[model samples]
Target: MDPGGEVSVSEAPSQVPPTAMGGEEEEPGEQEEEEPTAPKKSRLEEESLRAPMDAAEHYVELRAENLKDQEPEEPEDENLKDQEPEEPEDENLKDQEPEEPEDENLKDQESEEPEDENLKDQEPEEPEDQNLKDQEPEEPEDQNLKDQEPEEPEGPEDGGPQREALDFSHTPQMLTGSWAEFSSLPENYLKGCKWAPDGSCLLTSSADNVLRVYDLPSELYAPCWQLLPEMSPVLRMAEGDTIYDYCWYPHMSSLDPNTCFLASTSRDNPVHVWDAFDGKVRGSFRPYNHLDELTAAHSLCFSPDGSHLYCGFDKMVRVFHTERPGRDCEERPTIVKKRGVTGIVSCVSFSSSRALYACGSYSCGVALYSCQDGAPVAVLPTRHQGGLTHLVFSPDGTYLYTGARKDPEILCWDLRAPDKVLFSLQRNVGTNQRIYYDLDPSGRYLLSGDTSGLVSVWDTTHCASYRSSEELQPPHLTFQAHWDCTNGLSVHPFLPLLASSSGQRQFSWPSDSEDSGSDTDLGAPQERRQENCVCVWWSGPPGASAPGPEDTEDREPAEQEVPVCV
Candidate 1:
């Protein structure tokens, strides 16, 4: 296609076989220009995101501060000369540079003949006195798998707007608890939660596909009972089945207050409405559950009046009518195919109005999908391109909050002014991606249970911006919440309680409003299960100074590895 027909064929003398060669071979010099060069602007891109001021001052200060902190680099050149394979100055010998000695010479010396045996034995002893600078005896920093590779942009070839350097992650408090078997309910992990209208009972669902009933701690607060749901699913979860979310309608049932009706959606793709009063399956449906055949339901929320239910599924947000009884496809799912990751929606939450809702996804930033037609209001993305894991709209619908693994804090945005961040709270628990968290009904409290088994509580309304260590006050709570990582978390609709779920872990935090005796009740269980103990409201010395990574300046010169063959 170009000026020279042969030019495209061979810039290098064709390595064509003898029978195929028709032209002369090109010299080695020509190969230089033909080699592919990786993009050279990567360094510039990295530098542009750093603090723009005189890095000179920072570098000098950092260097001085680390003078005694860093270990000295190993001297590889001295060892290379001594261990290189030497040859006699014989005329018949070919001109060749010496090779560096093997770092594995200790084992090689034992097998080698006695001639170089002395040299072999000495190599083994040298390591004891000389420290290898390549490895440091410290924990490696955690890195998210998603960040290992940056996907090629679908837009401009050069890529879209450049991203800012990633911010830091919060260190989590390690919790210790498990959501195992309830007295008579599911034998699997906890999956969903809801509070009774009178706060007399707590209804929850687990992996076994059956709802478990726990008596509320009390009427003045939340109760702590272990009762079985009157009605539980017969055909329970299969080897691959799971329960992702569930919710209880906050209505004074015409039937009775003792029997409140609740809804449950499973990873198996079915939604079952149950009678909270007697725990009976009232109705069931599977709207948009069949989506191209991969079914997953991540979240669900009840309408303000408890008259309707909204469910999120792979690629769809279905609005189902609870007023009617029959499960007909025509009167079935109200599907909204707004945004999806591989056509699957990740998280969805309702704002104050029936028309405005916030939804987060695997592929796109969190956006407010219109209740009118389900179109995105605006894309919520950081300049650094963070992935959103959960979305919770404030009860009044004035603020929309989102959370993720890295900045384990909550980012609240005013719905009216979409661009400004209303509040940002940093969660210093184990920073993990896909972390599970929730906000209580009032939106005044935020709870995060992370991979580290730490169920940390935050005062969302207490502070607005970052306060340095000196200005920091004691947190509301930072204690051992779970033994394994927290898979999900939620709050009682009206009570001052929190529910966290992790590896086979479903723990209900009782109301803290009661007298001092409340602590004794909670601590009794933890004390009985001491070995596998879960500490509460844990206190300790100031956190260990953050452990940083290795010092790359200690690397040995590359010249030592590649000998001067000349």
Candidate 2:
């Protein structure tokens, strides 16, 4: 009953007044008579009467416990609870009501709304992360696309000078002939032929100490040409003595007049750079000897860039600045400090892809040097049987092919393993004359001429598995190219065409009168056949026909082909 008491709800029964539980009887005699023992109330009626009272007591006890645990409640709040006895019963009924749960649902929605918003915000980022993952693989593809960009420009830059693909699956045909063109003199013979870099014209050297330029027939690209006409020289350069060596400017182009010139060396003349158009001497590079006397170069070649001209001489090599001609030159001794390539430097060649150049000596020696300072790189052992005359590097700069005068074999040297020869190509070169050989632009085919009037073609893709000291590798194709000895061979820069020259010294002999055959012409002295001329052959597939003039004027039968397939 006291608000300050420490009594708990479980112990309240023991302390309650007896009247509340009917534990004490009101005067026994008066109670029995006056009330006649009011019928005992039913359990339901008693529970109904006690429920509100019990709820109020429980609420008061809870409030007392809360006040003790925290700050004390205000007196006004306690007075309000005591004044409204039925308020606690009403609160309990309200908690049990369905409408109160609806109020609770409103509270729950208030708490969960931001959570839903947070989940929505996260949903978009999930797709963004996925998008980033998708783009990861594309980065490399983008890089690859960028990498291929430069190669496209390089294709056009390099492709401008690239050689045209050739198909040699057909019988070779003669494009033109120059027999009558060179027949003006009795002993005149072609020495060599070279195609201009632009494929616009050709150049030829002859025993007459003359260099001739022949322009490609303009109308040859027409539909047909009934007769192969004799080719005439567009320009002729006469030298005082024998022409030792001559080469076109590596970057020679007809369209650029400044670059249209060639270099030549003669027996007693200085190196002359002649105009390709007018045959005028553009300049001269004069190399001097230790005696300070003017000397002629045995072989001459322009550097790959055409910035300098390299000349081969006996025991020395000279470099002349192309722009600065005359006596000014850089002398590089092949035999340096007592050791190096020996004999006359007969030939010089440069590698297009590397900083190296090769030199051949007449003493059967070959050497490599740095292009920068002419530093000695390597000197290959002497394997050639005669004086070295020509040296050429494979297009890839990984191999070197060497030929010697009077040597039967053109040796292929693998620069990667320079200690040994990769293979040997056999050709009949009995005389002490330079027998030139050429490789296709792709470096897949090797071609050369022999003294027996035959042209030979070798497939370089195949390598021999075994070796014998005296064995010579056979060519893929061999054919009698001329009636006289076929001595010069050159491949066109871009076309599927080959130019060859044939000639040799012939000795006249008197035939025995009694043993002379009936077919012999008695009026003429018995001499070797002299076919001293330039000829062009079409080396293409059988299906693709060559362009010729439509009219069949002055037509002649095709030469009898004697192709030997091996």
User: Which has the greatest TM-score?
Assistant: 2
Model 2 gets an lDDT of: 0.76
Tens-place lDDT digits, model 1, residues 304-382: 6665666665556666667764443322122335331333456667776547776665554566666656666665553
291-310 per-residue lDDT for model 2 (tens digits): 88999999998999999999
C-alpha root-mean-square deviation, each candidate: 37.2, 18.2
For each candidate, what TM-score against the reference? 0.47, 0.67
lDDT of 1: 0.48
User: Who wins the lDDT comparison?
Assistant: 2
